[model samples]
Target: MNTTHTSRHRGNDTGTGATTDRTNPPMTRRLSRLVPALCGLLLVLVGVTACGRTESSGATTTDATTTGSELSYEAVGACKDVFSRTDAPGAQIIVLWDSTASVADMPFPAALAEDLKTASLDDGTLSVIAVDGEAVAPRILAKDVALSTTGERDRPSVAKLAEVIPACVQSVYLNGLVPTAPGTDLHRAMTVAAEIAEPGATVWTVSDMMSTSGQLALSKAVLAEPADQAAETAAADAPVDLHRNVWKVSGMANAATPLLSASREWVRDFTRGLCRGWNASGCKSIELDPVNPVRTATGLPKDPVPPFPAVDAVTTATTCSFTLPDELLFDGGSAELRGDVDEVLNQPLALLDANAETTLRIVGHAASSGAYTAAELLALSKARVQAVRDRIVAAGIEKARVSSRGVGDTEPLAEDIDPSTGLQIPEIAAAERRVELIIEGAPCSR
Candidate 1:
């Protein structure tokens, strides 16, 4: 969990610590760097599986699920979400902005901002990540991170932050931040998203599905029959985590066309495999009107931009304690276990078993307000921590030995309340909800 940004106008910030190519030539490369920030459903209340979401075209679009180890369309970020008036509670959204040559023209961020502005955000978060062409093959900049969980009282400010979606995307070009590198590190950008993005957040990627990253060029030899480059590349870059209901925008890959279809499958399989490896949930590709790809800085699209991506984590491992985001272990709202939760818990469980002398404390928390009543919220919090304790107990750890408590909205990772109002800062309150395991062992010395 993270705090809200200082300024809501994240689109204007030049960002900190910028590094371009050694040679800054006139009319340099196409684009420079890429940013893919994360946001997700803080709670899995509505369940992503429910279908019939409204699109920008004023038409209903449904997601089609896929089985097997391959990737398939699951959720599409439609125009309706972008144009909607209010956002729901726990509406976490992450954008994989593609400044790649073919995806620069579409205008969808404005719609996303509409969705975010109207969001009844009690503890939800929004992050808009941008990735552009850079000097290095895998040039990625951790800039323009707009994590809005601090609880903003001014709803318009929250929406205004999202309204600059185009500006956030264009800032790279306007500020001359993107590099003129030869290849677009689409693979690396999405790959990084898997590792760092908020787990299970809606991922809206705007790209041409062209993985031109020098690391995995789609040449004849690379895409040969006996060997598949997509899988090979996925294995190389797939993180231990992955994307949420992905909504890909403006990609030219087609299922009907032979060559295009093959390319589409490669990208889809690669993306899905990558997410599956990270143990991420459902995904989908969204289609929008054909917008000309923008190359010049002046040509960047503009819209209501939500908060940008959050800055990287600055952890102080000075103590022997670990705090895991609820998104990592269970769905956003429910205590239902994700397939990898046990796999993730095994390490901690083993540690606990190895050091029986050490005491373990499980604290469950919930972000207040939104659709949930206060009592139900606390119950859910309790259920989450209990679930964790249950897992430990199932693994043979003594139930009595492990102390579990559900502390609802009391302990917050980021400061979400304002002293004057004595109320929650709507922008960042969502960060408060989490489960933390505190380990205390004075006897054992590291």
Candidate 2:
């Protein structure tokens, strides 16, 4: 949910700062009345069936359209939403519980709950772990995740996954008990969570980020602590081994540090450094709040800009948008296009061939995050489109037949989140940061 490192997605190199990925996605998806052939109808239906969402006949609507290798159906999830994507690997999630605290005392943040629901919609499974030091194995909270690979978000089948994920975490917090533990051993518990978290897995930790025992503890000297020395001497039992994966985790990141009472400022500073030390692949934050939660609700920093709640101007066969992640086409913080753009333009090539004379207007988009300001983002989007426009023109298309512009974050680039959970579908938000080609005219040559 953290947008800080959302750029690291889309297979971009880690060394170049967080980039982008097209693998998992989401947006404000809605069923587009999919009406595939009878055979395909049954095949796609499963992907769109609603859980508690209903219709006029009081029966869930059974409508969708399937194309290419695309199958659209709704699955009634605990809480879900519509989405779209190509066939891809499912996601794996590890939910780590800070068993040292009671659910009543250390309540889970509502924002983080939305993050869980957003993630569940992706194709994957959720495993729950209790950090009680009692060595409890991970348990599956949700499995066989349904994805809106087609990029639709409005389908009724979409449950408020945003709610479901956080709820699942709450279940563990409320029901889980620590029979034997010296104190809140956050370091050890986090180590366990880090050990199991794969690079691609999303980790949500519920705790105050405080370590009562084991390795890490409150210390004034901790400020001057070097990564290596801290690891060898004091942090021996701490989670040094899991920094790479931990670098990409989300959820509230603050913990109660009574030691920093002397310097309230150091609490925030030290925690921020610790999160940075993890080199989190997603957003990075070490809050000093009693509950410093760390989840980027559906890949965005909770922004002040109102979400583009309305579904976009519908795409007709002749004029439609093709999404290309800005990071995939260009490097981070810059508009320079990469050399392998031809590969990314496979669909464009086909469209060009059929609509040789039609004009193509590429619109560049950026997500709302700490990455850049609104104006800077708009310029970035515009520049990307201009770069791609140049490419298409060079490829024999008339220079006048193509144009580009940057709409910045003004359009439906990010997904509309459920107000309660503050989570949108992933693909929906990812869809916002892209170069979309708006082609001109009627159905192209077959």
95, model 1: CA deviation in Å? 3.0
lDDT of 1 by residue, 307-412 (tens): 2111122223322455665645665468876555764576566657777766678888877665678788788889999899988889888876789999777666
List the global CA lDDT of all models. 0.45, 0.46
RMSD (CA, Å), each prediction: 24.8, 24.8
lDDT score, residue 312, model 1?
20
| Model 2 poorest ten-residue lDDT run | 301-310
Task: Give the number of colliding residue pairs in candidate 2.
Answer: 71
TM-score of each: 0.35, 0.38
Off by over 4 Å in 1: 1-92, 102-104, 109-177, 225-229, 236-240, 243-270, 284-446
Q: Name model 2 segments beyond 4 Å from true.
A: 1-89, 101-104, 133-154, 172-176, 219-239, 246-267, 282-284, 290-446
Top candidate on lDDT is 2
List clash counts for every candidate, in order: 59, 71
